[model samples]
Target: MEHSPVRKLLTEAGQRQVEARIKAAEAGTSGEIVVMVVEESSRYRHASVVGALFSSMIVAVAVGHFQGGDGMWHFLGVFVPLFIVFHELLVRFAPLRRLFARKGDMADAVGKASLAAFYAKGINGTEAATGVLIYISLFEHMVRVVADKGINEKVDPDAWPELVGGIVQGIRSGEAAAALSEAIDRCGELLSRHFPIREGDRNELSNQIRY
Candidate 1:
């Protein structure tokens, strides 16, 4: 686990708390819930390149003004090194990269990452198709909740937005663990209503928060 990035969202104690919540939630239903946290869903390299070039151009313009020339050599002298430096900075610093990335692109990245995580973590492999994944990308400040087909066919589709909204708000308010606990409880309630615990229900996935 990358401790620094997720420390705010889940501390050591909070991780245990969330795991306990998952256990409690699963006791009432056959559904499996997995919460996955990532520093970033995607690198957004294009955003970094664009940001670097744009910033380098502004500095190069100032250099050209003082150097009294629109000469190619003059521009390249300042622009090339600066562009390299800025690009490296953007790559190393997620907040800078995010500053230049488009909202739609970030959303798409998170959506895809969440789906990938849903499968990667084995949530999709549950016997009853009663798995749910809650994915959080800290750099993007985005949350995605993915439910298996079994739950989707029975639960109201409209309810997802509110579920997602609460987590987003919790993230903004620095209460992600609490909100996620509640979300798990809600998922449990919904699952219990549709797929109550069976005679030989077994845990099909890990309860730990994936990092």
Candidate 2:
């Protein structure tokens, strides 16, 4: 199986820390916050193909030079099978493909995944519709925040980039748990300022960490 850096980083103790962070983030607001970490956001098929093709071409040229090939038959013999094999090998190794993918492509995939989680995890179904999702894709080193309609109406979308930046710093430092904890505290401050705890507020979402 392919290695999942995110899962490995968030060990049992790290998961517990994230769960605690969620609880603390929700302490003073009706807004619900959910965090999700995933191994990757996309298959990056083009990236795999590009890497394989480029590498295979270089190797095939070297092979042909050594083999003293001139005709189409010799070139085909040296390059065709080698190209196929290398392409398959590269595609099979996800990390190699991910290495070739552009940052923009990865960001787009992360955005889509965040939206999917927003709905799949019932973040959009909260009673007050103040649900916020903090989604991280380890392979791409991307962070996304999805806010429900209720929160969007009141809070400017630009307000989230700073929070996301903090999380990114955590991931970069290899202290994902601490990074998320700090971000959650920041988010709590933001939510409490705008939403605050109401007289009959109730916890509407689970605080467990999602992987």
Candidate 3:
């Protein structure tokens, strides 16, 4: 059987969604509310790694000084900050967000939103209309994928709780793409099961499209 391009596009779209989420989580947001959220998330991860390294290096240095040894202290002095600098570089250059979104203010929101919309389309199984899909894709690039902390307050108030809840759950669980893929499959199954287009309906749709 010939492979369907739709399936490939949808799979790529799903992978992009997961990667975008990981990038947003790592890069964080801006503005007053967003800044706080970003700071908290970054600190949470940084504290563990930075704090442990700092403590260990300090202990080693102190012990070396007490024992009148220069080797361990000298080595740690160079190693500690080098590690910190490298960690900062990774955080700054995380490939996920960098590849999709431009490195600027507008780019951050637009990039995240675009990815989310693609994810939503994949979930809804309505990605076939080239024009409509492209139009919706514009909005996808505009929406901000704010950090997961306190998302309820950050997102639009009118959005369905279930929708927001699902995204939030995916972010927290670190399985947004898997969850979304499963959701899309479930949606497809439901559509096929309950609203399948019969031969007559397919003919009608084809006619409508032609006209």
Q: Rate the local accuracy (lDDT) of all candidates.
A: 0.88, 0.84, 0.34
Indicate the TM-score of model 2: 0.91
> How much is the lDDT of residue 11 in candidate 2?
70
Error of 2 at 178 (Å): 0.8
lDDT of 3 at 28: 23
Q: Model 3, 62-99: lDDT tens per residue? A: 66677677675576775576556645644454332233
**Stronger candidate by lDDT (1 vs 3):** 1
* Highest lDDT scorer: 1
Q: Please give the RMSD of candidate 3 to the true structure.
A: 15.0
* Model 2 agreement with the true structure over 1-211: per-residue lDDT tens digits: 1245546667778888888978987989999999888878888888887887788778878888887878778777777787788778877876677778998998899999889989998999998889999988878888999999999988878889998998898778888888888889988888898899898888998997666
Cα displacement (angstroms), candidate 3, residue 127, comes to: 19
